[model samples]
Target: MIPLTEEQQMLQAMVRRMAREKLKPRAAEIDNTGEFPWDIVELFRENGLFGIHFPEEYGGSGGGVVDLCLAVEEVAQGCSDAAVILAGQALGSKLILLSGSEEQKRKYLPRIASGEFIPAFALTEPGAGSDNVSMQSRAVRDGDYYVINGRKIFITHADVADIFTLFAKTDPEKKARGISAFIINKGTPGLGIGKIEKKMAHKGNHACEVILEDVRVPRENLVGAEGEGFMEAMKILTTSRPVTAARAVGLAQVALDEAVAYAKTRVQFGQPIAKFQGIQFMLADMAIKVEAARQLVYNAAFLADRDYKSKEAQRASSMAKCFATDTAMQVTCDAVQVFGGYGYMREYPVERLMREAKVTQIVEGTNQVQRVVIARALLED
Candidate 1:
């Protein structure tokens, strides 16, 4: 079992209450409209939810990973849409804080932590997913500025981002190591956002392609040492995935909760479905997996918060992310089965829950890459 600090518990309880009061009722509408829940995002900002895990000097609550995990889980339990918005802000901000200079942090951190601004990570391209070294986007040096040319696809919250934490290749000869991280405002010259794409789950979270053509950013905009972009990206992903795993656990819990409630109420063969051995077994399995995934996620989060430098953290994170999201998919699919035809209807929340589970496996790095990570860890050991 994982233990939370008193502060973490308090934050968790507060966010849990907020989730039930604000997010649960609106989930269906958000899913139906496929509209980004900018209002809920605004609500989070107003309540200081976005910056809770940042340093106090940066207008944050002086919180930590435990606080962030609890917050995200609570939000996801109410609505994955809101949880993702929280994750995008917190995780994207973390990149800047870890690597950005004093001025960059001062410029972005205060507003980011205060929800006065939103940030995004732009890395994946139409030609790159797990094999990101294959990306052809280039950043050429020109008169104390970098002229960036690239198109990043599947960027989360691209439509509403304020500052983009992006990656472009600085030296192709170094392969992935030659990549560099940059911060560019949304309205920079030659920067453009594509139309938002329709998605299966996480519908309320808008994603679009970001294009950069001859965009110029000051050399000071670089994050960390040049040619360290891929390394920093890996570090950020490692630290962030465990929180995402927490969200997946919450997704599984909601699925299990809905399935249990339905089984206890729906009658079949002159008795409640809960009485059937089949329904009983499915619920038990879901509960078991949910517990395991939650434990892994929390443990990983604990390890990461202890200044664990980050490769092992990445391993544990991928393990948790892969296991928890796969569990969510299975449990939510079973939930749909438990609800029977009613589950298939648009009115049932479980249908949306089911759709949401699919994306968890795909994003935050795919399960296929998770397997590769696991394999590499063993070989290295």
Candidate 2:
């Protein structure tokens, strides 16, 4: 383990304790009910986890990206969905801290960090998922305010968020360059929520679609300059990807732990199944992949938080996200296999964990997109 400061070490221990005590035991209930785990979110907020990646002045603990990533891994070790819920606060706060000005910081960050305000960064649209620049949302200047129209799909916390950090285009012809970020209140007129999506995983994170039909936004609500949204979003993703990667590592580790523990007790051929060469090899691979993924996640997180001189930080972030999520899928699947026919039963938690593992490879830019990002970075340099 990397040596941490006294406070950092304490924070890690606290997260592990909370995860085991609070999140792990309730994972089944959350999955079965498919409701937002507001209680768990409240626990995180009370624990000062909401503003983890921001400065202390903003009601945060002054922790950086890597510290927050460590926190995410611990939370996910118990429940991946809860970890993702925690990520909404971390990721949303990161976007504003990176792109918003001092005034915006003072106005928004503190409330968010304190959990007085729940923030949502709305970017993805039904048509614009991987290609974020293709966003059709428009922000038309109307005197002192800009009227925003169009919709965003698959936005985390769209239905329940108090504030939405939104993306829209001021100049359609400029495409990506024209895109600008804005902060719109949830109660604003003409802003509405569409259907809440029922997803295969992360049901507790509560993803939904947001509709802004001529929604009025003050000039002051603009996050950064027009034509800067794409870059701003990229900046957030470059750092946030590692958090997702870390969460994936946590999921893989849990799967491995569950599999190993089961293998030690379950009987097969009059011996523990763990004695078999096949089971041993599977466990070995699971352990290796999880540790490797953790390293990549930490490396990327370190570079982002420390503002490292390494030129490859973005690529490292993409690599970590891609590799770690892939490991989650493979390891979770193998974990189920290790359980034999019993793994398929509802009595086992591996099935739920396996379902949760599939999404990590798809979100925060798909693994295929990560390869493209890695290639583009390498070629550009």
* Best by the lDDT measure: 1
Error of 2 at 10 (Å): 1.1
The C-alpha RMSD in Å for every predicted model, in order, reads 1.1, 1.4
Query: lDDT per residue, candidate 1, 46-158, as tens digits?
Result: 78898888889888898877678889998999999889999889777887887788989899999999887889988889989988888888999998999999899999988
Q: After superposition, how far is residue 250 of candidate 2 from its true place, in Å?
A: 0.6
Worst 10 residues of 1 by lDDT: 305-314
Instruction: Please list the residue runs of candidate 1 whose C-alpha ends up more than 4 Å from where it truly belongs after superposition.
Output: none
Give the 10-residue window scoring lowest on summed lDDT in candidate 2.
304-313
RMSD of 2: 1.4
TM-score, cand. 1: 0.98
Residue-level lDDT of model 2, residues 100-193, one tens digit each, is 8899999989999888788887889999998988889999999999999999988887777899988899998998889999988879999999
For model 2, state the Cα shift of residue 338 in Å: 0.5
TM-score of each: 0.98, 0.97
